[model samples]
Target: STVLLTGANGFIAATILRKLLERGHTVVGTVRSESKATFLREQFKAAVDSDKLKFAVVDDITAPGAFDEVLRAYQFDAVLHTSSPFRYNITDIDEELLQPAIQGTTGILDSVNRVAPSVKRVVVTSSFASVVNRTKGTWPGKVYTEADWNPTTREEGLKDVGSGYYASKTLAEQAAWDFVKEKNPRFTLTTLCPPMVYGPPEQEVPSMVKLNVSNLDIYDIFNGASDPRYGVWVWIDVRDLAEAHVLAWCDAAIAANQRYIVSQGNFSPQMFVDYIWKHYPERAAAKGINKHSPGKYYSDEGIYGVDTSKSVKDLGMKYTPIEDMLRDTLKRFEDLEAEGK
Candidate 1:
């Protein structure tokens, strides 16, 4: 299969690109710049040398028909769109978060519909934000599935960065489904909604400052910047999430035009802290990492539960244990530190 992966240099997309190549698929990855393309080429030298991996630059995904040129250039069997912004430190919510996410998604779909009839499947990296209801504040009995939709309005999104991100994901995914129904494109769509993805990145990290958002949350624990207690405990390993994308793309049996919630179940900041303390005791002690009373900060009281049964049953998903994920993540950080990065 020939696949097009947008945001190929991203933390998650790097792993997806790797899995796609390992599965014997030719991949054309889209990055924002040639520097990123060079970085990816270095990261996957064998793939690039073998002509299994290639890259194209799509500088601004928000622009109208941002993907048209790329779509027309490649004979793509499928596409994995993971190019939306996820930052929160922005002033203009509409410009930074909303417009890019919505337009980037719709633009790609429109471009594919118009130019790439050979493309049969489109998989999007939607967020758990789209499936979570913020208003409920973790309704105790609520078991969130793919069926749930975050009812964040545009007005609510404009209020703050967090709300804006949630609303952006919700509205963008909504627009995707709406486009499929209204336009009836030749291809089918699959969206994966995963929560708080965490793992070692397959791409190059020049410094700790360059860490992706979710991995940054883990780094903060040692840096003394994180609160001991946090909510929305669900998360997935990046490798697992990447596999889910590949599985969703190739498996025809997995229903199309549906959202899959890919999660490894519940977790808390304390759980991460505990794991580090137990495994890397020296580093934990050096960093003065608190071994927050076992399970004290973790509770099911105010947090919602996630059901990954659908993903497991449908995509044949299997989760990477938290221990392994943390170990690899910490090891990656150690390597970076040794390199003085």
Candidate 2:
């Protein structure tokens, strides 16, 4: 089957691109620039030459008919939409976050609806931010599941950094569901809501300073720049998350307008620090990694846990433990540092 992977160079989409290739699927990846398309071609040179991989350029996803030409060009079996604005620090919430997040999603869906007749499934990378209500803390023993939706409005997103991001994700995902409800396209939709995707990055990391948002805490902790402040303390490995996307794409039973909560379990920065101190003592000592007292860092109020039963049953999601996620993330940092990157 042929797959169209949007945002092919992103931290998570890169893994999805590779996984689809490994599964013997021909993939057409979309990037914002020629440079990113070149990077993908070089990264998967063998696949490209064998005619199993290709790329396209869609610079601005919010533009009308952004994906129309590409959708018309190929009979894609699945369209994995992973492109979204995810900056934490923002000046213009509407332009920077909401417009790209909301319009970008709708534009692609509209294209897929109108042009791509062969596309069977469309897997979107929604975030846990769209599911968890940060303001109204979760009750005890109340594990968040796919049924929950983040209650953030566009007005709330205009208030602050956190609300803006939450709102972007919420509105973007809501738009997707609404499109499916109204348009009733031939392709089924599946949304994966994973929190704080942390693990060894598949994409090139030029420097430790340029680590992705999810793995920044590991970098900060190793360099002694962080205390054990556990914020939104849950995660899923990038690799695992990518596989879940693939599962959602291939499995017709699981692809029917399902929203998956793709989390492994609870985690914290202190846990990473402890693992490094105990397992890689020499490096921990060299970096002067400090383990703050447990009382110092704690989970945010109202944030509790996530349930992955649906993912496990529907997508066959076998989670990678947080300890391994921490160790491997640090090892990637070490590998990059050794090469002086």
Candidate 3:
């Protein structure tokens, strides 16, 4: 099968690209620039040489007909759209975050429906931001599933940066479902909403400074931050999330038009800090790492729970343990530090 992977240079997309290739699928990845294309080519030189991997540039995904050219050129069997703005440090919430996210998503769907009729399955990387309603706070005793939706309005989303990001995801995902229902496109849509993806990146990390947003939290702890501010407790390993995307694409019959909340389970900052301190005592001592008291800040009852039963039963999803996730993640950071990156 030939797959078109959007935002191929991103943290999650990079791993998804690797998984697709391993499954004997030819991939055409889209990046924003030529440099990004070159970097991926270098990363997968063997695949490129064997004509198993290729790249295209789509500079502005928010622009009208952003994906029209690419969709017309390739006979794509499936599309894994993972490109969207995920940054928080910005001035204009609507321009920098909301519009791009909403438009980029709908733009691709329009293109696939209008031009790429060969596309049978389309998997989108929507975030858990679209699943959990922050206004509800902890929502004690409530278990969140694929059916839950973040009730963030466009007006409220414009109030703050965090809300803006959450709104972007929610609105974009909503737009996707709406498009399919109204347009009746040839392709079936599947959206994987995973919380706090963390794992060693499949692509090369230029430096610790350039680590993805989720991995940056771990780096802060390693860099000797006394407080590990735990936010959303649910998480999924990058590898597992990538596998979920591939499974969502391959098993078209079961995954058709489904929204899956992919998660390993719950975790806290204290859990991660304690694990590092216990396993790498020497490094912990050298870096002056402070381990928060066990169970001091986290409680299963205080936060909302996640139900991944749909993902497991439907996609045959299996998750990496928290300890293994931390080990490989920290090792990757250490390797980068050792190389002065």
Candidate 4:
């Protein structure tokens, strides 16, 4: 299969690309600039040499016909759209979060419908923020599934960065469903929503200071800068996520226009501290891991749970344990630190 993966240089997308390439699929990754395209080629020189990977540039996903040329050029069997603004620090909520997310999603679908009729499936990367009402405190014993939708308005998103990101994901995913219903596109659409994704980086990172947003949160916990008071307590390894994307794309028997929640399990910073203190005592002592009280960093009793049975049953997905996730991630962190990154 030939897959068109948007944001292929991103942390998740890069892993997905690697998985697809390993499965002998031809991959055309879309980046926003020539420099990034060059970087991807150099990074995946083996795949490029084997003619298994190629790249295209789409400067703006929100522009009308932004993906038209690229879609028209490739005979893509599937598309994995993972390109959208996700930074917590936003200057303009509409410009940064809402517009790009909403427009970028619809634009890709529109282009695929118009130009890439051969494409059979499209997978989008949504978030748990789209389903959970985060404004209210976490509800204990409340198990969230794909049936839930966040009831947030643009005005509500404008109030803060986190809320705004929630609104963006909710509305963007909503727009995707609406487009399929109204436009009646030929390809099946599936959305995957994972909360608090963490794992080792697959894409290049110049420095720890410039780590991606999701990984940055994990790093903060190690450095004891992140407050457990604001923890979400759910996580999925990136490797598991990358496999889920492939399974979702390949499985056509499952219903279309469906959403799947992919998660490993619940977690908190205190658990990470405990793991570090037990496994890497010297490093933990050097980093002052036990300086803070673990009780304060644990998830509140009212924290909610997510149902991931659909992914496991339908896609044959298996999750990695949180302990393994922390160990692998910390190993990568230490390697990067040794390199002065």
Question: Which regions in candidate 2 have their CA more than 4 angstroms from the true location?
Answer: 294-303
Model 1 Cα lDDT, one tens digit per residue, 1-341: 99999999999999999899989999999999989888789888999999999899999998888898989997999999998888878999999999989999999999999999999999999999999988887677679988899988999999999999999999999999999999999999999999999998787788887788888888878555665646467899999999999989798546588789999987777878887777878888888877778666445466678999989888899999888999899888778878897
**What are the per-residue Cα lDDT tens digits for candidate 3 across 1-341?**
99999999999999998999989899999999888877789988999999999899999999989998988887899999999988778799999989989999999999898889999999999999999989778777889999999999889899999899999999999999999999998999999999999999776678887888888888888878546866788899999999999999887479999999999988887777788888888988898988668556555468788999999999999999999999998888888889898
Q: Cα-based RMSD of the predictions, in order?
A: 1.4, 2.1, 1.3, 1.8
TM-score of 2: 0.94
Error of 1 at 161 (Å): 0.5
lDDT of 2 by residue, 228-302 (tens): 546576789999999998899786475589999999987766777778788788877787777565333344553
Please list the residue runs of candidate 4 whose C-alpha ends up more than 4 Å from where it truly belongs after superposition. 224-229, 295-300
lDDT of 4 by residue, 1-341 (tens): 99999998898998898899889999999999878777578878999998899889899899999999988887999999999887887889999889999999999999999989999999999988888877565678888899998999889988988888999999999999999999999999999998888889878788887788988876766765653435576789999999988998776458367799999867766777677667787766776655456445544475788899998888888999988888899899889888888
Please give the lDDT score at residue 50 for candidate 4.
89
Clash count in backbone of candidate 4? 0
- Compared with the true structure, all predictions reach lDDT values of 0.88, 0.85, 0.90, 0.85
Error of 4 at 306 (Å): 1.0
Candidate 1 positional error at 273, Å = 0.7
Task: Output the better candidate (3/4) by TM-score.
Answer: 3
Error of 3 at 214 (Å): 0.5
